[model samples]
Target: MSELLAPALSGAAAGLGVAMPMGAMSVLLLQEAVRERRPAVAAAAGIAAVDLGYAALATALGPWVAAHVTPAEAWIRLAASAILLTIATRGLLPTRPAPPPTNASPGAGASAGPATELGTEPGPSAGAGPGPGPGSGANAGPSAGPSAGAGAGAGRTFARYVGLTAVNPTTALYFAALTTAQGAALRAGAAGAAFVTGVALASLLWQQALVALGALAGSRISPAARTWTFRLGYGLVAAYAVKIAFPLP
Candidate 1:
């Protein structure tokens, strides 16, 4: 109610404070945006969704969260950290070449590309080209390429970010602190809603800004720079995994 205004500002500040830190999840989203701007945006959306979920829980259900969430927290963090390690390991390994692009356009016949003209196997550009078929327009994405498998992967990617954020004990602690930072205002039902809403909005805005920055940076970088950046991202992610997996006792 009238008490909501000040708490809302505090909530927004808290959301921004938590989200603005550059970390594994943040780097991954940025890297994805730089490498493939469109899909990266979807990943970023997933990040925002998790932020909103956590904010809502902290603001609206803070009174009950410790009882409900604390017991499973350790196991959840371990599982999430393991997943992050696997992803990091995969990134560090030399990437196997994707088989030459296939003409997956419906009913399209085999066509010769630069490779075929030289009596060599067709390369990435062969099947990746547009086909003169119905419904297989330019908007039809390449099959078996970086852009391929995005549909199923999108859900997994979203789930991964959400899981990582949710399992992080610190995220819950941060929210808990924020909940108690104020007194009657946050405890008031309607006033608490305003604070939660502010947190969600700030989180989403920060995430969008990050993705947009990555998208812009991706376009401007050379191939070599992108490669170096990719390696750096992997390294940072691996470091985070290690930290999470072996927390100081």
Candidate 2:
């Protein structure tokens, strides 16, 4: 039992070490949440689900994968690195120019204009000019307003999240290596299982916490800030890819 306990602990530690880092998935989740709100949660959930599946596979078939999947590790890392670079570049690109401001202000240069005169029948009163109506202003339209479109936007966000995760070869390789490394401990039976379970649970717990924190922060950040955050996050993910591709060892 004591011997088994060590492996399980080791397995759990390995799981935490690999999963705890704020990698591409983490950055993607944060950006999605901040940009699309509710959809961000769905995207994060999907990523976590994938991680759980990978971890389980690593524990269950560590040996088989290690023996047969010789080129799998290399392939996955290359793919992940490519995707990260693309996403980072997209984020860094300049956004489309904002629409020019309209000159619809009441009586900007009109002589004796009733539109600007106070207490006039055709014009707005002193305090009531061409102000925005209820739920219809510069910040209250379909493009920026809160409406059903938000839900649709969430779906789009989820799709992007799926794309990012699916293309990440590094994640697959990481899992494979992890499982291979912990094989002996896992085969040791119940104790090994317990350790794997502990590690998996810890990873899930930490990732969920990050998702929640990201969602909360997203709610408060401005649109511009969110955009910059997305860029920075993707840039970091790309940096990680470079490191993985050219490790010191």
Candidate 3:
């Protein structure tokens, strides 16, 4: 009983270690949905999938990697920080043409296309919530109508997020450290499985919460607020990357 308890708690704690940064992922996803009118379900799934994969893999391989790979973590952190910094800089760049709608067309069909299919929906109008419309600010660019490549681009966002998460590697290192600390308790197969399961559960719950929150926040915020939100989110994520890259003495 105590054996299982230790691992489960460790796993949950590890999963939640990035609560602040992960919250940024949520905000970014929601902002993407509202401003770009893209569906976030795929992005949310990508984020959760990476989290679960990293947790499980860390639990399984953390001990060996911790022993062998500890020295290179700094390099890994530097590379990841570079990736995050690039992403942040891009966020602060001149806004592109707003992406086409990622949702299904309003009517006339049973099998709705994937919510990520671009150019499949109608143009934004004054009454359309969240999207740039009649009330959009002077600086706010007009949202796009339809384009040939929007689907591929929408899909790429999901893959890019997965790539960014997979390359970070610090989360796995943290998991490995936690598993190393709980060696004896996790020696038992049942206890180890319990810990990994707890981790998966926590990751899933947290990611789902992000998706729900993003969906809810879509219409409530004005376009300017949405723009600043991305700036803040990107900046925060970049800061986290820097912290990972250059830990203080």
What's the lDDT for all of these models?
0.65, 0.58, 0.61
Steric clashes per prediction: 0, 1, 0
For candidate 1, report its TM-score: 0.73
58-161: candidate 1 lDDT, tens digit per residue: 77667576556667666666776787787777665522234544656533324544444343422212322111111112243555454445555565656766
TM-score ranking, high to low: 1, 3, 2
Question: Candidate 1 clashing pairs?
Answer: none
Q: What TM-score, computed on C-alpha atoms, does each candidate reach?
A: 0.73, 0.61, 0.65
lDDT of 3 at 182: 65
TM-score (C-alpha) between model 3 and the true structure: 0.65
List the candidate 2 regions with Cα displacement exceeding 4 Å. 1-12, 94-96, 99-163, 166-178, 181-184, 188-196, 241-249
TM-score of 2: 0.61
Tens digits of per-residue lDDT, candidate 3, 169-207, equal 666677778877766666577877877777766766776
